[model samples]
Structure formats: C-alpha cells, structure tokens
Target: MRGGVNMSGWAGFSDEELRRMQRKGAEQRPAESGSCPAPGPRKAASSAPRSRQQLQRERALQQAAQRSRAAGEEALQAGQQLSEPPPERTSPGAPEQTAGPGAPSPRPEVKQSPAAESEESREEAPEVKELDRQEAEEVLRTRLQVLQQQQSLMEEQNRVKKDLLTRTLQLKSQQTQAEAAMLKTVRAELQQLETMATNDISILRGRIEEADWEYSKARKRYERAEAEFVSSKLDLHRKAELKEHLAEHLYAIIQQKELRKARKLEELMLRLALREEEREAGPAVETQLEAENVETVKEADFEKEAGTEEGAGSKKEAESPEL
Candidate 1:
C-alpha cells in the first residue's frame, strides 16, 4: 500500500484535481492520538490502501480513550479526584451536551472486588486504577502503530515534495528562458539607442540616459534571475540525489524482505514435504532396522555353535589317541 499509486488517475489529473485529491485524503483521515500527530495523515490516505491499519489504530485509540474516561468517572464516583488530559479529536460537529437537573446522575463505579475503606481512599485512587493501567498499555501499543503510520506517511509526503520541487524547477527554467528573450529585446533597444546617437545631441543625450536606465534594470533582472535559477537548480539536484538514494535503499530493503519471506516459505514447504515422506516411509525404515538386528543375532548364534563343535571334536580326538 505504501506504493499503491493510481498511475492512470494520476496521468489524467490536473494540478487542481491533484490538490483536491490530496485535500480529500487529508480530510478523510481519522483523528490522531497521543503521539506527535505531526502531519501528512491525509496524504497517506490518498494512497487508498486497503490495509485499514490506520483505521484500526484510530479505533483502538478511541476505545482506549473511552475506557480512560470511564475509569476517571468511576474514580470520581469513589471520591477520588482525578485529572484528565484533553480528549483526542473525533469527527467534526459532535452533538453538544448541556448540563441540567434533568441530566442523568453519574453511574457509580462498580467494583467486582471489595474495597478497603480508609487506606485505599487515602491514596486518592480507586480499584479501577488497574483498568486505567490496562488502558495505558493499549494506548502504548496504539502509539506504536501510529508511529508506523506516521513513518509511512512521512515517506509519502517526501515523494510528493519531490514532485513539487521538480515542477518548481521546470517553471524556473521556463522563467529563465523568458528572461533570455527579454535580454534579446533589451539588446535590440540598445541598437536603437546607437542609431539615435547620430541624431540631435540633446535628444541623443536623453535617449542615452534612457538606455542606461533600461540597461541597469535589465542587468539587475538578469542577475536576479541567474542567481535564482542557480540556487533552485542546486536545490533540485540535492533533492533528486537524496531521493535516488532513498529509493535505492528502500528497494534493497524490500528485496531483502521479499527474499527472506520466500526463504521462509520455501523452508516451510520443504518441512511439510519431508514430513509427508517420513510418514510414508516410517514403517519401512523401522522394518529395515529390525531386520538388521535379527541378522546380527543369527550370526552371533552360528559363531557360538561352531566354537562348541570344534572344542568337542578336539577332545574326542585326544581321547582316541589315549585309547
């Protein structure tokens, strides 16, 4: 989703259309929470990623906030004073709540466990502090997710900024070309001034002064344009260089991650295949091992028989000689 560009839609979009898309993305962005909440959530949305990661994070944060609020209320009911941070922004135009006698009483903080009287209240916290603790953990985890979203969003903004810089450079180049044309016009005017040099001396003097003034203005304009063009060109070069580096690094990282994934998948498949083979061959392997053991036993028995027969025959031959 980080790279899900609508290339077709992009080609068709005018500057105004592109801007509208960017704004629409920003407006549709869910409210941010405890973290930096810096910027570019809207731009991130323009990617139109189906991940729903941001949406899920926002929802988790809302739930955590709700739990925090409930805990505060319960603590308040238990005669424990609690301070609360400002609530995170939600969608616009939330209905207002007015205070009146008709308003419902705050719900009592119900505790599943019995409360110890004076000692627990002395600390100025209710048993629901555990609930608050759990909610804090949830908030921390949500913060991690928000940080990731911000990272991706930051990357997207960088790309957008790069495009803007490229456009600005192009415009600047065009402006410089226009300035060159102006310089040509000024040269033509100087030729006119030279032609007038032979006319009435007083008239020529006036024209000379006019030409000098025009030349000065043109010179200043040219200098300014040249300086601006050089600076912009340098800045554009730096941005492009940095962009290429980032692209290369990101590409390498993606390749590495993909390779790792492929390896893992391969390993898992191999394990599965091996498991199937083992299951199929298990009995046969066991039978072969058993047969080897049986053969060894038989060979041992035959050696024992041969040794006994030779000993008995040698004793009988000795007895026959004695006879």
Candidate 2:
C-alpha cells in the first residue's frame, strides 16, 4: 500500500512534467516580452505614476510566482526521495556480518504468534495512512501551483489593460490642451480684428463729420446768394413800374398840346372872314392877321423846345446808374 501511494504521488507530477512546464514557461517568456514592448525613451520621459493598488498587485503576483516555484522544487525533491531505494533493514536481534562475494550468508527462521503479526499490521496501517496523506498533500500543492500560475497570467493581462487605459487618458489630455491653446489663439485674433474694425469706424466717422460740415457751409452760401438775387429782382420790378407810369404821363401831356394848337387855328380863320366884308378895314385886318400868325409860330416854337427838353430828361433818366 505504501509503495502504491508513493508511486501515485510520483505519478501526480514527475521530473519530466516539471521540466516540460519549465520549458513551456521559458518559451512563452520571450513571446510575452516581445508582445509587451518596453517603453521608448520618449514614453519613459513622460511615464505616468503607478497607483498604490497597481503596485501592490504587481508585488503580490511576483510573490505568488516565487511561492509556486518553491513548491515545485519541494515536490521534485520529495519525488526524488521516493524514487531512491529504501535503506537496508535489519532486525534488532540480528547483527551485521561481512561475507565474501563467493559465499552465501546463513539466516535463522523464527516463528511469529498471531498477536505479534496483528500488532505489526496495526503499526503498518498508520504508516500507510501517513503516506496516503502525504501523497494527497503533494497533489494539492501541485494544483495550488497551477492555480497560482494562472492567477499570475491573469494579473499580467490586467496590468496590460491598465497600461493601455493610462496611455489613452494621457493622449486625450494632450489633445484637450492643444485644443485649448488653439481656442486662445483664435480669441486673440478675433480681438485684434475687432480693434482694427473699431479704428476704421472711428476714421470713417471723422470723414462723415467733415463731409457734413462742408455740406452745411455750402448750404449757407447758397442761401445767402438766393437772398441777394431775390432783392435784386424786387428792385428791377419797381423800376419797370416807375418807367411805365412816366411814359403814360408824357403821352397825356402831348395830346393836350395838340388840341390847344388846333383851337388857335380855328380862331385865326374867323378873323379873316370878317376883314373881307369891309374895304376900309383891309390894312388893319391884314396887320392883325400877321400879328396872330407870328404869335402862333412863336407858341409852336416854345412847345417844340419844351418837348426837346423833356426828351433829353427822359433819356438821362433811362441811362442813370442803379441805386
């Protein structure tokens, strides 16, 4: 039973198995290292700080791997001890003797009671139980080591995930900072444009004021010229009215002079008719006619002189300078 237990314990995991597992681990290490590349110089320069929980977890994984390796070593040692031949056993009553290689040693036979046999069997039972327990413990240890290895692998995967998350967050923060800088630049440009626009508006307003002032001045000058023209037109209208009145009064005076000359000639004709009726009155009548004719000619000459004087006065008035 003890040998069976020993064989079973050894069978649970042998040296070959340990070597195979170790070789597998060794082969995977390079691939794992290659898959998870080391940080570059630039990445190292901006390396993020690890959290307390992450550091603690990494430390725990390392401790578990160490423990698993130690357990594997102990199991290997146990298997080696089981594989070695058991030490030679001798009864307390017998003594060790040296024998030549060509001769055989003689042995004594002894009889055993049922009680003695039973006692021996009873003692062997606990030894068998102990071997079985030891085998079970070894099996459990191997299983625990496997579990630990699986746990370590899972921890590595989690670490990689954390690293990726950290890198993504860092990139996002950098992008946000860049955007903020661009926004600041845009705002500055907008402020500069607004300042330039304000300056231009001020300049335009000044020009508009100047134009308005010039327009007001021109309007005033036009108003003054229009007033002077209106006064001149009024003066011309008054002169025209005065000339019409003078022309009408001169025409009336000439008509009255013509009527008076016609009346004087009719009186002279009546005096000639009376002188022909008496011969004694001929010379007196002829002398009176001559006097009348002379008076008529003298009055006509005076009227002509008056008309010439009036014409000269009217001509002088018409040529006079403006007030």
Top candidate by lDDT: 2
- 239: Cα error in model 1, Å: 99
TM-scores of all candidate predictions against the true structure: 0.25, 0.39
lDDT of 1: 0.51
Clashes of each: 1, 0
Candidate 1 accuracy as TM-score: 0.25
Off by over 4 Å in 1: 1-137, 192-323
Q: lDDT tens string, model 1, 1-323?
A: 21221111111222342344345434433222232322354344444454443543343344333434454344445555444333332221222222222222322333332244333332222222223444445545544554566678889999999999999999999999999999999999998897777566878789999999999999999999998888778666665666576567657766765676577557556655676677776755565566556556755675576567556655654454334
> lDDT of all predictions, in order shown?
0.51, 0.54
Q: At residue 232, give the lDDT of candidate 1.
A: 72
